[model samples]
Target: MTAMSTVPWLTILGLIPLVGALFVAFVPGSAETAKRMALGFSLVTLVIGIIAATQFDVSSSAQFQLGEQHSWIPQFGVSYALGVDGIALVLILMALVLTPICLLAAWHDVPEEVGPRGGQRAKTYFALLLVLETFMVGVFAATDVFLFYVFFEAMLIPVYFLIGRFGGARRQYAAMKFLLFSLAGGLVMLVAVIALYLQGPGGTDGFLIERLTGLSIDPTTERLLFVGFFLAFAVKAPMVPFHTWLPDAATESTPATATLLVGVLDKVGTFGMIRFCLQLFPEASQWATPVVVVLAVISVIYGALLAIGQTDMMRLISYTSVSHFGFIVLGIFAFTSVGQGGSTLYMVNHGFSTAALFLFAAMLVRRHNSNSKRIGDYGGWQRVTPALAGIFLVAGLSGLALPGLSSFVSEFLVLVGSFSTQPVATVIATSGIILAALYILLMFNRVMTGPKPEELVAEGVTVDEGWRKSSGGTTVRDLTTRDKLVAAPLIAAFVVLGFLPNIALNFINPAVDKTLSYVQQAIPSLNPAGTAAEGSSK
Candidate 1:
């Protein structure tokens, strides 16, 4: 075993964003000032996140690096701790990269009325955003279970304010609903955590995750406890029946906020499953595999069907995320190392792909000057706005898991890994691929083809007091330089990661394999594949 140092730099990195948020809130003059401060802070965090990523020892398998541990609440055996292996580290970095992009997008994306409201509100919003970032990073890095739980619960505050204050017509309703649901989940999880703590190796002590994983519990208790945790995660993952809040929340919130909500925040749920359900309650996860796999399969098909019927672009993307999450959950419960690793990678890939699509859609909505994102609203857009169409096409293709796109590799790995333990579910889930193609292609055809609408072709059309014109005096305008700058990194990442996934896989596989080994050790009979990988070298 490598003797890793216990230094919680990652937690410190998370805190930097909160500090930035405070700075923005207290020293703001105008909305633009507040926005700039937020952006600058996010960028600083990004730089720190990059430094942390660079320090990561990629060759290590499952052992956390740059780990820091110290006592926080000695009475309850809770401690301040943080670290990450490959999967968590990658996700954290992805969140860091996207946060700045979202801030930039929000510079003009948020409605003026819902914006800063001058000094105080603008400061508060930025403060909330910064706080949200801190919690998100903390959740990924925390090595202590109690610390993870605290961060997990703490994350909802900023998101609540973000959606409630700056969302669409139904901002208040949607924000409240988002808060209530997540809080309910968190409360349930809190009880489960407390129960686990009380029954830990030494009663009323040790909430360190690694230490607790060594404690023994019977199958029944384990399964029950797993459900407590799983219910919380399922709601957060917004899996199927528990997903009602997602469509409305995404539809009503500003695009930039939705990007964080969907891209990074939702990931916390899936991340928890990997950390808690599989690692700490391995036997229970094995026992509950069938139920989880079935639900995951249903979410896949159901989310796609619902997405096809949606008129709101934001809502449609939200449903697509529900579907994508299904695939991730399926991979997790399949119990193969490949499946687990693929699930982890898919989580990262989906974050990027969805962020690109949502941001582009925001641009479209801005250009059109209408709340309606109906496919029929525009036509022959490719001829008028080639850049917009091109970016949309790239994003759509990525969503459908097109060959050489990043999603394709992760989706393929997930399906392959899932095939062994869940052949029936895997086969059914594979149909989601076809459905994905149909919906994505249909969206493209509706938006990019056919005759250009007469109204859209009119130049200098008055929109909310501003004169707006489509490109070439006969069609919609092409993507501006700013749009190109925003989208270039996203598209390039999709291509680079798509072709050479080894960059991510090198970091992910070891941790995934380690997790699988832990699960199998706890439930030897469930090793259906009979592979002798328990002792295999990474």
Candidate 2:
């Protein structure tokens, strides 16, 4: 069989989870069955993602790969176009990898109905998760701007429900806030998308990314259009002022939902900044860089300070992400291939590391009877749940950029690369690292290291009657076999990516080079090659 005859793997990859969502919704089955079906389908998607990655030509030109395009709306110049570069491919793979783990992590997370029949809840929950998965894959793979916007807007629907329906107390408030914030961003982007459409040469070719990139717009128009797109991305990126919605959403949602929100959905914001803002409005990007860099630095320091102040564990983690995302944005705006490539790799690493932290924290909350998320409610947990505490430490250390963790590699590259272009910002941003250590270690100490509360011990003792009969009358238990299974992949990812980040950077660097070339073309003096020249002369 010719290579062309091979399965349309990218299309299949997007479809499997979507089709699985339908099956979960319609099939007559128990909650257990729905959970299994969702996991199975997600795993299939993960396998397909692997196959697609293997098929990718990393050494090829820095253009969209494995493309599949078909005319969708001839009148609107829109088409069903999908493709991936190294950057998109890695993010897509991260999404696929995380979905199954999320399924497994949430296997017993959904509460059963107290009254008559709790028939519909599991079906609805699993179905929405699968649907979200489909959109996640589609968003990363979409090549056409209109197609990306469609996926971008559609993904929010499932997430809204995932938070509103399956979240903690104040779920409604958090869900509404999340919805409103996202809708506002989407609406702003829609206007920009329309503006872009109107400006293009009207035809079926108008909305194609390649076509849009070649447009010659006036400077004022370019900057205005850039603002439209950048505003949406900044909100989604939840930079500083726009970031207020994330803490509440994370605090209220289930760990799995929060994981996907921060890990996958938030990546879209930074991804758009790179793919759209930088690529389409190169001069405008450079024009906006001074202000954007300042915002990024504020996000870094401000987020870290806020994280240190958070009483709730989930909110604390969410704030830390704000801080981490700042580093990613800084690397992106630094305008060096090394910086861009580092930012791309940071996206992947942050997803896995954040997933581990959120999911593990969920397990701890579960052990604590699901009510108390306050750090004060959990002290000396390490004494009772050493395994869980150890895992939490590993995850937290990754967040703090410990040596030999995935985050360290990415964070290091971001600083080193950005320093070449923006030294003052990079130096200021470095202080966030110290703040990171303080927050992570302080949280660990408060929640895991202090004396065990007598009330906590009493509760654990009351719940585990069998513990008195077994060893030493220890009340609290460690992570179960299933919990270990869910955590293993995330832990492995941290280690693997930490040591062999080249596996991702090798693919990412080519795209970074191409994007930098565009930016250099726009502002010749800002060229990274100039830095190389300076180094050679020295």
Candidate 3:
């Protein structure tokens, strides 16, 4: 075994945001100061994440890097164990990168007097966002099942408050639905966790992933345990039937909040599937692949079809995520190295792409007075807000997997890889690309092009409503300096990753190979010869 690195970078990465959240909460400051402080802390965390990435040994055979372990509950075999592989590292970086962008985008989002807190609401809002960042880091970096579960469940609180308190008109309903669905999934997972503990060697080693993976469990027990974990993950992934809560939650929350919710938090589901399901119950994972793949295909077509029908811009973006997640799940369950690697990269790419779309959409709403989320509310926006339209167009193109964008590379790899294993399903899922184009272009055409609305013309263009109340006049502005600052990085990420995916794939492929190795070990019949042959032909 490689000796654990002495520097606790992962701990520092997780703690910085947490500490910042505390400081923001108790320290007295104006909303602008609070926003600046949060952005500073998040950027510092991003630097730490990049440093950790640089330090990571990409070529190592070790499954996890940057490991740190400490005893937490000796009797129950729980420990404060933290580590990341290439896959987790990428997702953690995604979370770190998006946090500051979200803060910058939301600089003026919260009203001065919201709920009972009035002037203090901004402080509370930024604090909650930072606190959520801590859980996001912890969830991805955690090596112990117990620790992961704790971070997993703890994540909902901050998001719930973000939606219920700071969101749109139906925020309370959306928050409660999100909470209930998530809690139910957690409870199901709790049962599996306890059962796995009992099935393992007794005492303090029971909850350790290294120890549990070594246990020889019966197939029946493994399958049941897999269901418990899979159910939770599927809900979190918000796949098809279990995904009803997401559209509401995404639509109701502010775009910055929605960005984090869909872009970062939801990745936890697919992440858990890879970490827990495939790693811990390899046989069960193989057994469930057939049914899961079907559901994934359904999610692709279903989500895309629904997205095309949405009039509300926020809800439309939310539906698109459901479709994209389906691709991630499809790639994972396909059990090929390329498939899994593509899925992992897709998680990172999706975060940036979705962040751009959500944040830009929010900016559009704000420019339109933040009073109307409907696509019909604005027209010929491209004529006046060309900068906004250009970025929005790039984001939309990325969402639909335009060539030379990050999403296209990942989506292409996923389809090619999955085709080697499940050709029929892969072919069916191809139609989703067409549907994606339809929804994204259709939404873009409706909101960004055509003629300017008569309302803006008749009202004399000086907007006095919503966030634009101080703007003084009816001329809709283009992307502001701050907006470009938030947008530029996301656009750069799409371009860089699109062209040089090896930057990520070099790290991701080894971890994916390790995962597929375990799957083959559990089910020797699932050898990669078939996938290899298919790839060679291509």
Candidate 4:
């Protein structure tokens, strides 16, 4: 076996942001200085993440690479251990990439040193983003179950403040709801974590996932623990009934915050389903699949339906995420290698697509006369801000899993993977595609391409009279250079991943196979499509 990299690359990747957060918070500087510092740190973190990715050997059978283990609390059997499979690595990299984009996109989100208190708030905002990056990286990288839980719950601190302080009018209400839901979920998972730990072999290495894996957990006990973990993930995934907090949170928070929250943090839910729920309690996972699949299907359809009913663009985008998450969770529990791999890939694709959507939508909203978020507030924007409209359409198309975009391949794999053992549920879930088209196209048509509203348009506007003058007599602007910089990489990712998904899938598929083998989900009756891959164990 190739010895694990000794430099603790994962820890460094996480702590670099931690150091950056502290620096940004304590140092006296203008908001511009803070923003630039934050961007530089996030970019460095991305570079490190990419370096770590290069070290990952795709053909190796190692379950985790670039491992780091250190005993932190010997008496209690808790230690600080970090590692990543292909799945966690991709997620960590995704978060890293999004962090810098969010920073740039939010350059003026908090406004630059406007009031006496503005500079301070701005510094705190960017610092909090850095802090959130640390937690996000840690949450995905931690191999110790206790460490994972710590990072898991710790993420709330930065996110809570980001929403409560920097968000819109109902920021406090949204932040509180989000906290309450996450706390409720975390509390349940804590009990399960404790229970699962106690059930494992007690030693100095006690809380490591390695120790917990394949433990002889009793069937009833296992099911209870699975419920605890799955419930937490479901809430995080914000599936159906528990999803009420998301729209408020998304709508109230800054667009960059919304992008990270929905795009990256929320992914922890589905990520947990794979990393903990299935691997730790295989029998329970199989046992719960039937019902979970039903709930996932409901989330898929219900979320899309709710999105269609939304007039608020941010709220609409938020609902679409709930719907997208449904597809992710559906792919996870579907039990086929392709389904699970697709689910992981979907997480990454969705992050970039949603980031572009939220950021672009925010740009458009900020430019509106009243800065209104209402879909009814604008029309024929394509005739004025064609560049912004163009990227927005790309984002919206990706959301609907349009044929030429990135989401199509992942969504297709999910459906194909689920169809064998879950034909009925898969067919029912497919209806979400039509609903998606309805929401995305309708949203585009209403907000982007149709006849202009009087308030949103200059008095003498016509279709060909593009670049219409606003009420202030200034011609409406398209995308600025900064906007294009943000748009280019995201659009490139979509195009590249769409036609050449193997870029990610090469590693993701092997990880999926390992997970399936470990969970023994390759049993012929349950997942015939993956039976051929049964022997490909980690």
lDDT winner between candidates 2 and 4: 4
Instruction: Write down the lDDT of every candidate, Cα atoms only.
Output: 0.81, 0.86, 0.88, 0.87
Best by lDDT: 3
Model 4 CA deviation exceeding 4 Å by range:
1-3, 114-118, 453-474, 521-530, 533-538
Model 2 TM-score?
Answer: 0.94
Candidates in order, TM-scores: namely 0.93, 0.94, 0.95, 0.95
Give lDDT tens digits, candidate 2, residues 90-170. Answer: 999999999999998987667666544565687788889999999998998888899999999998899999999989889
Error of 1 at 237 (Å): 0.7
Q: Which sequence of candidate numbers ranks them by TM-score, best first?
A: 3, 4, 2, 1
Q: How many residue pairs clash in each candidate?
A: 7, 0, 4, 0
Q: C-alpha displacement of 265 in model 2, angstroms?
A: 0.4
Task: Summarize candidate 1's per-residue lDDT along 276-347 as a digit string, tens digits.
Answer: 988889888878888899899999999999888876678888999999999999999988877777888899
Error of 1 at 381 (Å): 2.4
Ten contiguous residues with the weakest lDDT in model 1:
458-467
Residue range with the least summed lDDT across 10 consecutive positions in model 2: 464-473
Over 443-464, each residue of candidate 4 has an lDDT whose tens digit, in order, gives 9999888765444433333322
lDDT of 1 at 406: 96
Point to the candidate with the largest TM-score: 3
